[model samples]
Every structure is written in structure tokens, then in C-alpha cells.
Target: MFDILVIGSINADLVFISDIRPKAGETVMGKDFKVLPGGKGANQAIAAARLGKKVGFIGCVGNDDNGKKLIENLRGNNVETQYIQIVDDVPTGVANIVVAEEDNSIIVIPGANYSISKDMIDKNMDILLNSKLILLQNEIPMEVIEHIIDLCFGKDIKVILNPAPAVKLKESIVNKIDYLTPNEHECKIAFGNPNTDGLLTKYPNKLIVTVGDKGVLYHDGNKKVNIPAFKVDVVDTTGAGDSFNGAFAVAIVEGNSLYESLLFANKAAAISVTKIGAQEGMPYLEDLKGL
Candidate 1:
């Protein structure tokens, strides 16, 4: 059985480096362009796999060269991609990433990712129910996420969701997630009311709020605390959060204390930002040992 199961979109990322983001209707010559195998789900899967988790991926890719390469890349990282379905109708997902100095902006074309049906989630429900942990991101259809959450109910498995690219999930599903990781923007988007607001207060289980640079905030019932980020010279920080979430799951599954897991995750993410590419920048166990 997989230690962790991930269900979300899959894509190849086209990353470009520019002195600054080009203004709308203005074209600036980019300094460099680099292509990398990435997708929020793919990145997280590799992140966890690199941290020694038996991670299985459930998503779709195109039947084209990109799809074949995408599967090969995941397998190269030891992330199980046998369940990655290839469809001819829609091309593989693609993320157009532009790095403006230290910051970056992205525009994604879901392609085959959008066709990952609810039925697929139902069929793979067993994988998630049996997993020690399941990581989720908003790259897939909401129904897919909902089905997985519903099926994992009362099971031994834990669900760790990073509500990225920010979308509010159905309240019922929110109540079911074992853990929720939302960045500052996502945190604000999940809750609008100041009285009964705060994603932590709304959820019955664990919730973690990640603030870039300032660090992460972990809240479980009456307990809440902050975990500071490791100091590093950041380059392109596209997949730092994905790395952190994946590493967090690995540390937790390995029986590390929550604080320790988060600290380790923080370091892993810090290391990721210092380099370029998503999975390419991800550090291995020995690399973290040096930190």
C-alpha cells in the first residue's frame, strides 16, 4: 500500500526568467527560458517520494510526448505513476511560469487534468483509504477531492490538504479533511468573517496557515503556534510550499513530532527556494542531513 496517495492535476512547466514581470500589453525580452517537469500534484509527489515515502499518483496526462515524458520523470523520482491515465482528447496540462526577480506568476492550462473524473476517484478510493496519509492540492477537480475526502471518513488514513491556487471547498468536505494547509492568501479566501472566521476555527480538525517568509502557523483546537522559516537566499520560489507540505507528511508518517516535522519541512522548503526548478531543487535525505 502507498504511504501517501496524491490526486490532482499533472503538467509540464515552462519557466522563464525576466528582469521583471512584463506589463500587460508590453513584451520584455526574457533573460532565459527553462522547461521542467512540474504540476502542483507532480511536484508534491516527487517531494514526498524524495523524502522516502511510497507515494502513488492518480491523475491524467496527454497521450503526447509530454505525457510520456511526464510519466518517465515521475518514475525516475521513484514516485509511482502507474495510475497516471493518458487521454488523447486533451493535451497534458501546462503551467506557464514567469519569474519576476524574486517573485513569480503562473497561468495554467488544465488540459487532461480537468477530465480526472469523480468515477476515477471512486475507483481509487481504496488507495487513499489504505494510505497512512493522503496529500491534496487544488490542482484537480473539486469533485475528485470531495469524493476522496468522503471515502476516507473514519478510515485510519489522514488527509493533508494544501488549498492552493485558492478555491473554497464545500463546507462538508472541509469538515472531513484531517489537516488543512493554506497560505496567507488562501487563509483569507477560506474565511471572510472575523467573528466565526479563521480557517482553524471553522474546521473541526487540524489547520495550518502558511505565511511566506514569516513562516507557518499550526492550529489544532486550543493549541496554536508558529514555525519560522529557515534563512536562505531565495531564487525562483515556485514550488517551495509543495516541498514543505510533502516533507511535512513524510516527517509525520515517520513518527516525528509535529514541531520537528514542520521544522524539517521549513528547512526543506528553504533549501528548495535557494535553487531553481520544482523537483530538481528538492533536496534528498543526505542533503537535509547536512542542514
Candidate 2:
């Protein structure tokens, strides 16, 4: 059985590195460009797998070179890809990223990611139900996510929802999640404002909000714990959150307490930002020993 199953998008990231972002209808010279395998789902899966977790990925890609490369990359990282499907006549998902001064702006073309339908999920129910935990992101269809959430509700399997590229979700759905990890900006999108005071009151220990560089804040039933981010010189912040989520899932599955898991995840995220690319920057378990 897999320790964690990630149900979301898989995309090829085309990144351009530059000193500054260009204005509307303007162009700028970029220092370099690189194509990397990334998708919140794939990145997290690879991150967990690299950290030695038995992770499985569930998503859709096109029957093309990019799709093959993405699957090969996942397999290379030790993530189980039996659940990843290839759609006909569609291109694999792609994200055009511009990294400037260690920050990034992205425009994603959903492509085959949108083709991960309910039928696919239903067909993979055995895989989904057998996993210890499910990791989800907003990169896939909301309905598919909701259906999966409903499937996990009141079941033995726990659910960790990362509300990225944020969208408003129902209270019923939110209440069903065991953990909700959202960044500062995404927290704002979920609650109509960036403030988490009300969210903490509502979700209590279920809410985790990641503040870039500042660390993470979460309510732990009795009190709030703020895990400080590890100090590091950041080279690129693209996959920092994905690293955190993947590590957090692994830590939790390994029976680490909330605070301990948060600390581990914080360290992993800190390490990821110190390197240049998204998946390229993700740290292995050995790298976490001294951190």
C-alpha cells in the first residue's frame, strides 16, 4: 500500500530566468531557460518519493513526448505511476514560468489535466482507498476533488488539501478535510481576506498557513504553533510549498506529531528554495539529516 496518493495535475514546466519581470506588451532578455517536470501533484509525489515514502500519483497527461518524459521522471524519482493515464489527442499540461529575483509568475495551460474525469477516479477507487493519505491541489477539476473528499470522509484514510491557485470551496467540503495547507495568498482567497484568525477558530488544528520565509502557522487544538522557516539563501522559490506539503505528508504518515512534522516540512521547503529549479531543488531524505 502507498503511504500517500496524490490526485492532481502533471505538467511540464517551461521556465525563463530573468533579472526583472517585463511590463505589459514589453520584452526583456532572460538569463537562461530550462524545461522541468512539475505539476503540484507530480512535484509533491516526487518530493515524497525522494524522501523515501511509498508514494503513488494519479493524474492525466497527453500521449506525447512531454507525457512520456513526465512519467519517466516520476518513475525515476520512485513514484508509482500506474494510476497516471494518457489522454488521446490532447497535449500534456504545461506551465510557462518566469523567475525574476528568486520569485516567479506562472501561466498554466491545463491541457490534459482537465481530462482527469470522475470515471477515471472511480476506476482507481481501489488505489485511492488503499492509500494511507490523499494529497490534493487545485490544479485539477474541483468536482473530482470534491468527489474524492467525499470518498475519504469518515473513512480510515486521511486527507490533506492544499488550496493553491486558490478557489472558493464549500464549508461542507472544507469541514471534511483532515488538514488544509494554504499559503498566505491562498488563505486570503479562501476566506475573503488574508487573515487566518477566523479560519483558525473555524478549522482549529486543521488549518495550516504557510508564510514565505517567515515560516508556518497553524492551530493545534489547544494553541497555535508557529514553526520558523530554516534560514537559507534562496535561489528560487517555485517549489518551496510543494516540498513542504510532500515532506509534511511523509512526516505525518510516519507518525510525527504536528509540531515535529511542521519542523521537518519547514526544513525541506527551506532547502528547496536554495536551488534554481522546481523539482531539481527538492531535497532527498539524506539532505534533511543535518538541517
Candidate 3:
């Protein structure tokens, strides 16, 4: 069985890097533009696979050249793509990422990714049931994620939900997830402000707020744990959180304590930001050992 299974969107990222972000109806000369194979699911899968974990990906790709290219990329990286479905009518998902010196913005046209569903998950039931860790993100329909969670709810699988490009989700998912990984904004939108007093004493089983550069904060069942981020020269912050989740899952599967896992994951994410592309930036197990 694979150590980690990721169910989410797969997209070709067309990035435009500029010194500063553009305002509405204004155009400026761009500094750089590059296309890379990306998407949260694919990024996480590649991250774990390169770190020496057996990983599998389940997502939909359109019957197009980009789709075909992404499938090839995953296979070359040692991530199993047999469960990734191909949709006939819709085009492959595409994410237009605009990276400014200070921050970034993204607009995704889900395309075939929106077509990903529970039926597809059923077809890959054995794969889902056997994996040690199930990693999911909000890129897929929330209902589809809930369906998978319900199936693995009582089973031995541990569900790691990363709510990014953060949006509203139902209480069903909030109550059931074993671990919820959210960025600072997502944490505020999902729960209240992180600065709230006694946040751990409140509905403590659910969340882990990932604060970039600052580190991570978790409300464990009893106490809150603060995990600091490693210092590194950041090039592109894109996909850093995904790297964190992937490394965290792999560490957990290898039986590391939560503190150790968070530290290991933080280092992986720190290294990821120092490079440009998403999957291309992830540090391997040997690198992690040195960290």
C-alpha cells in the first residue's frame, strides 16, 4: 500500500512573475513568465514521492496535451498516477498565477477538475482504503471530499485536510477531519482570530494554522503547540504549505512525534520557498536528514 494518497486538483500553472502587482485595467511590462506542472494534489504527491514515500494521486485531467504532459511528469517523479481519471469533454485545469515581489494571486479555471467526484473515488476504493494517509484540499468539490472522509471515517486511514485558496466549508467536514491544515487567513475565516485567548480550550481537536515564516500553531486535544519555521531565503512562496502537509504526513507515517514532524515539515517548506517551481522546490529525505 502507498504511504500517502492525495485527492485534489491537478493543473498546469502558467506563472507570470513581476516586481509589483498590477492594479485593475492597468498593464505593465512583466519580468518573467513560465509554465510548470502544478496543482495541490500533484505538488503534494511529488513532494512525498521525492522524499521516498510511496505516493498515489487521484484527480481528473482533461483529454488534452497539458493533461497528458502532467501525467507523464508524475510518472517520471515516481508517483503512481493510475487512479487519475481522464475526462473527455472538459479541458485540463489551468491556474494563472501572478507572482509579485511581495505576494501572489491566482485565478483557476477548474475545467476537468470540477468533474472529479465521489463516483471516481468509489472506483479507486481499494487504493483509498489501504493508504496510511489521505491528503485532501478544497480544490475538489467539498461534497466529494466529504464522501471520501465518510468512507474512511471509521477505517485506519488518517485524513489530512489542507484548506487553501480558503473558502467556506460545511460543519460535517469540520467535525470529522483528523487534522485540518489552514493558512493564517483560512484560520481566521474558519475559526476566529488566532490571537484569541484560550483558543486551545475551545473545540480543540481540529485545526493547525500554518503561519508562513512565523511557523505553525496547533490546538491539540489538551494543549496548544507552537512550531517555529526555519529561516531560509524565499524565492517563491507558492506551494510551500502543500509541501508542509506532504512532509507532515510522511513524517507521521514514519512514526515521528508531532513536534518532530512539524519541524521536519517546516524545513521542507522553508527549502521549497527558496526555489521557484512547486514540485521542483521540494527537498528530499537526505536533505531533511541534514536539516
Which candidate leads the pack in lDDT?
A: 2
Q: Model 1 over residues 66-116: C-alpha lDDT tens digits?
A: 999999999999999888889987899999999887988999999999889
Where does model 3 exceed 4 Å of error? 192-200, 203-205
TM for every model, in the order presented, reads: 0.94, 0.98, 0.94
Question: What order do candidates take by lDDT, descending?
Answer: 2, 3, 1
Roughly what TM-score does model 2 have, to 2 decimal places?
0.98
Runs in model 2 deviating more than 4 A are none
- Assess the local accuracy of residue 123 in candidate 2 as a C-alpha lDDT between 0 and 100: 96
Q: What RMSD, rounded to one decimal, does every model reach?
A: 1.8, 1.0, 1.7
lDDT of 2 by residue, 81-185 (tens): 988999999999999999997699999899999999889999999999999999999999999999999998998998999998898878898999989999988
Give residue 227's error in model 2 in angstroms: 0.9
Q: Report every candidate's CA lDDT.
A: 0.84, 0.91, 0.85
Q: Per-residue lDDT of 54-103 in model 3, one digit per residue for the tens?
A: 99999999999999999999999999998888999999999999988756
User: Which run of 10 residues does model 3 get worst, by summed lDDT?
Assistant: 192-201
- Cα-lDDT of candidate 2: 0.91
